[model samples]
Target: MKGSALTFVLGAQEKTCYYIFADKPNSNVGYYFAVQSGGSFDIDYTIKAPDGSIIVNEAKQRQGDWVFIAEKVGEYEFCFANGMSTFAEKVVDFEIKLDDDFKAELPKAPDQPIAVEGMQHSVDRIEAKLNDLIKSLQYYKTRNNRNQSTVKSTERRIFQFSLFDVLLMAGMAGLQIAVVQLFFKDSRKQLV
Candidate 1:
C-alpha cells in the first residue's frame, strides 16, 4: 500500500482538482479529506474514474472517506469545490492511497527450511493493524485542528462584542452629560 497526504488552502469560490494514476486494474483506491478550518468547514467534492464516470459526488461535506476498486488503468480525477463560500477560505487535508493486492513471493535459499506460513500471516495482520492505527490518529488530528480554529474564532468575536459594548456605553454617557450641561446653561441665561 502506498499513499500521499497533503494540506491546502482553498480560496472562496474556487475549485481545485487533482489526478492520480492507476497503474493496474482492480487496484484498491482510497480517498479521504477533512476541512480543518474556515467558513462552515464544508466543501463540495467529486471523484471521477478513469473512464470519466462519477464514482462519488457530494456537496457541503465537512469530511469524507471512500474506497473503491479501480477497474481501468488510467488517471483518476479528484476535485474540491468551494463555490458556496463567497469570502472565506478553507483549510483542508486530504490523502490518496493505492493498495495493490498482489503479494510477491520472497526468494528463499533451497538449503534453508521454508518459513512457516503462520509467521507470514502474523506479519500481515500486524501491518493491517498498524495501518488502522495511523488512520485513527489522522482523524483525531483533524478534529483537534477544527476545534482549535473554532475556539479562536469564538474568542475573537467575544472580544469584539465586548469592545463595542464598552464604546457604546461611553458614548451614551458623554451624550447625557452634554445634554445636562446645555440645560443648565439655558436656565442660567433665562434667569439673568
Candidate 2:
C-alpha cells in the first residue's frame, strides 16, 4: 500500500475537502485522521461517494481509522468541518492509502540454494518494526504542534490582560489627584 499524508488548517465555520479518484471499482482504500489542535481537539469528518451519498460521518471526533472498498470508479470526497468553532481554526492531520501491487516486485527466495519456509520471516519482522517507528514519530510531531499553538494562545491572552491592568491603574491615579486638588481649594476659600 502507498499513501500520502498532510496537515492542514481548517478555518472557523468552514469546510475543507479533498477528492480521491479510484480508477477501477472495488479498489481497496484506507484512511486515518486526527485533530492536532484547536478547540477540544475535535472536528467533524465526512466521506461521500461519487453519487453524493454519505459513506461515513462523525462529529466532534479526535481521531479515526477505517478501510473500505470503492464501489464505483470516480471521485470520492473527504471533508473536515470546523463549524462548531466560532473563532478557533482547527489543525488537522490526515492520510489516505490505496492498495498497490508493489509487493509483487519483491525478490522471492525461491532461487536460493537452501530454501527454507521461514526465510522471509526476518524481512517481514523488519518491515513491521519500521512501520511502528513511523507511527511513533508521527504521534510526537502532532503533540509538538499542539503544544506550540497553546503557548501562542496563552501569550496573547496574558498580553491583553496586562494592558487592561495598566490602564485601570492610571485611571485610578488621575481620579485621586483630582479629588485632592478639590479638597485644597475648599480649605483655601474657608481661610480667605
Candidate 3:
C-alpha cells in the first residue's frame, strides 16, 4: 500500500484523516521520518532507530527522506545527521503521523478481492510531500541565511562606525590641543 517514503499535506484542513497504508502490515510496525543532512550545504547523513529499534537502524552516508515499516507501531523512531561536519548544529525537521485507528478491511472468504487503489495514491502522496518538503526547506533555509547575514553585516557596520567615531574624536582633540598651545606661545611672545 505505502509505496513511498513520505507524504505531505499542505494546509490539510483540520482532519480529513490521511494515513500511510503500509505495504506489509504486521503487528510489529515501526514508522520513521527524518531529514537527511539537516541545514547543511553538503552533508551526508545516516539515520538509525532513535530508540534502538531495528525499524531503521544503520550508519549511512546519504541524504533524503526515508520511511520504514517495521514490525510494530509503538516502537517507531527517527533521527537525522550532518556527516559533512562534526559541529552537531544541523537541524532537520521531521514528523510522524502514527495511527492504529484503521485496520485493513478484509473481504469475506466468499467475496471478491477489493481493488483498493492504495499503492498508486501512496506513491503520489509521498512524492508530493517530498517535493513540498524540499521546497519548504529551501525557502526556510534561504530566509534564515539571509537574515543572519543581514544581521552580521549590520553589526560589522556598526562596529566600524564606532571605531571611526573614536578615531575622529581623537584627531579633533589632538588638533585642538595643538591650536591652544600655539595660541599661548604666540601670546607670550607678543607680551614679552
Candidate 4:
C-alpha cells in the first residue's frame, strides 16, 4: 500500500490538480478530502481516470471519502476547485491511497511451530485494528479543525454585531436628548 496526505490552501477562484500513478491494474484507489476552513467549508472536486473519464464529480462538498478499483494502469487526476468562492480562500486536507490486491505472506521457518503461526495471525489482526484506530483519529482531528474554524467565525460575527448594536443605541440616545432639549427651548421662547 502506498499513500500520500496533504494539506493546502486553495485560493479563491482557483483550481488545483494532482496526479497519482497507478502501476498495477485492478488496484484499490482511495481518495478522501475535507474542507478545514473558509467559505462555508465547501469545495468542488473531480476525479478522472487516466482515460480522461470522470470517475467522481462533486460540487460544494465539505468532505468525501471514495474508494474505487483502477482497471487501467496509468495516472489518475484529482482536482479541487474553489471557483464558486469569489473572495474566500479555503484550507483543504486530502489523502490518496493506492493499494495493490496482494497480501504479503510471512516467511515460514522450517522449525517454526504452530504456536508461532498463530502468534503471527494475532499480530496481523492487531495491526489491522491499529490502522483503523489511526484512521478514526485522523477523521476526528479534521472535524475538530472545522469546528474550531466555525466557532471563531461565529465569535467574530457576534462581536461585530454587538459593537454595531452599541453604536446604534448610543446614537438613538443622543438624538432623543437633542429632541427633548429643542422642545424645551421652543416652549420657553413661546412663554417669553
Candidate 5:
C-alpha cells in the first residue's frame, strides 16, 4: 500500500504543530520538513511519542529529515513550534512516510525459469531508480522554495530603502530653499 503524503501552510503565531498518526511497534517511519517561508526561515521542531516522550528535538532549524522506529503500538505526534516569533508567520512543507514492508501477492506466471527471474529483477531495479528520482525532485522543490523566500525578503528591503531615500532627498531640498531665502532677506536689509 502507498503511504500518505500531505503539504500544508501553517499560519502566523502558532506555537506548536502536531500530527497524530498510529504506528505498530518496530515499524519504520520517516519524516522530512522545510520552512518554505517566514521570519528568519527557521523554527524549532519536536517529535513526541504516544506517552509524551520526546523522540526528536531540533532547535532553530530551517529544514530537517528523520527516520525512527516506533517502540510502542499507539499514536505518535510530530510537531513544529514557532513560539519565538511574535509578528511573522511561517509556511511549512513536510512529509511523513511509512515503510510497512508489505509485499503484494501477484499472480504466478507459467514456468519459464530464466524469463521469470530476469523480469522480476528488472522490475525491482526500475522501482529503485524511480524512488531515487522522486527523492531528488523533492530536494529541488525545497531549494526553489527557499530561493523564493529570499527574493521576497530582498524586495521588501529594497522598497523600504527607496522610500527612506526619497524622504531624505525631499528634506534636503526643503532645507536648501529655507537657507537661500534667509540669505536674500539679510542682504536686502543690509542694502536698504
Candidate 6:
C-alpha cells in the first residue's frame, strides 16, 4: 500500500493548497501541477517529484507561469496565473486530492498488482510463514532459560549464523538502495 496518489486542479486566482503525505513509512510519492496564463488553460496538470529529493518542484510552462506540487508532507507550494496583466484572477479555484494509502500502513504495491485472489494467496503464505517464524523465535528465546546450554548453542549456530541471515541482509540493503535510486534518477522524464 504505497498509499500514494497524485491529483490537482487549475486556477486563475493566486492561491495555494496544502496536501498531506501518505501514512506509509518512508514512501516516496507526491503530486505536482501547474497553471498557465491566457486562454492556454490546462486543468489536469500533474506534480512532479523533485530529483534527488522527496519534495516536488516546479516545472516549465508553455502558456503562462503557475504553481508547483505540494512537495512536503504539510504545506505544498502553489501559484496562479490569469494570463492577463491585471489583478489576480478573482474567480479561480484549486482542487487537489491525494491518495489515502496511508490508511493501510502497508508496504507499497507488491510485485505484480495483487488481485483479490493474489491477496488471498499472499495471506496464506504469510500465515504459514509467520507461524513458523514466530515459533522458531519463541523456541530460541526460551531455550536458554528452559533447556540445556548445549541446545541453545546449537540453535544459534543453525539459525542465527545460517546462510539465510547473511543473504537476507544483503537482499534487503540492495532493495532499499534500488528503491531510493528509482526516485532520484530521471524523474522528470516520467512526470512530464
**Looking at candidate 5, what is the lDDT of residue 55?**
92
Clash count per candidate: 0, 0, 6, 0, 0, 8
Q: Candidate 3's residue-wise lDDT over 70-96, tens digit each?
A: 443333334333444544343333344
Top-scoring candidate (TM-score):
4
Q: TM-score of predicted model 5?
A: 0.83
Clashing pairs in 5: none
Best by lDDT: 4
lDDT order of candidates, top first? 4, 1, 2, 5, 3, 6
Question: What is the lDDT, from 0 to 100, of the residue 19 in candidate 2?
Answer: 83
lDDT for position 157 in model 1 = 100
TM-score versus the correct structure, for each prediction = 0.86, 0.75, 0.38, 0.90, 0.83, 0.26
- What is the per-residue lDDT of model 6 for residues 94-123, given as tens digits with 9 covering 90 to 100? 334344333322344655555655766777
Off by over 4 Å in 2: 22-28, 36-41, 50-53, 69-75, 85-91, 100-119
Local distance difference test, per candidate? Answer: 0.90, 0.83, 0.45, 0.91, 0.78, 0.42
Q: Give stretches of model 3 more than 4 Å off.
A: 1-115, 118-123
- For model 6, what is the C-alpha lDDT against the true structure? 0.42
Candidate 1, residue 60: how far the Cα is off, in Å = 0.9
Model 5: per-residue Cα lDDT over 54-150, one tens digit each: 9998888988777788777777788777878888888887878777666553445677766777877778888889977977777788789888988
For each of the candidates, the C-alpha root-mean-square deviation to the true structure, in angstroms, is 2.8, 3.4, 11.0, 1.8, 2.5, 30.3
Model 5 spans with C-alpha error above 4 angstroms: 12-23, 105-110
Clashing pairs in 3: 8-129, 28-71, 28-72, 29-70, 29-71, 29-72
At residue 126, what lDDT does model 1 achieve?
86
In Å, residue 51's CA in model 3 sits off its true spot by 50
lDDT tens per residue, model 2, 1-192 = 757789999989999898888777887878878788888788998999999999999999887777888889888899999999999888888998777334533455656724443556666778879977977777787778778878998999999999999999999999999999999999999999
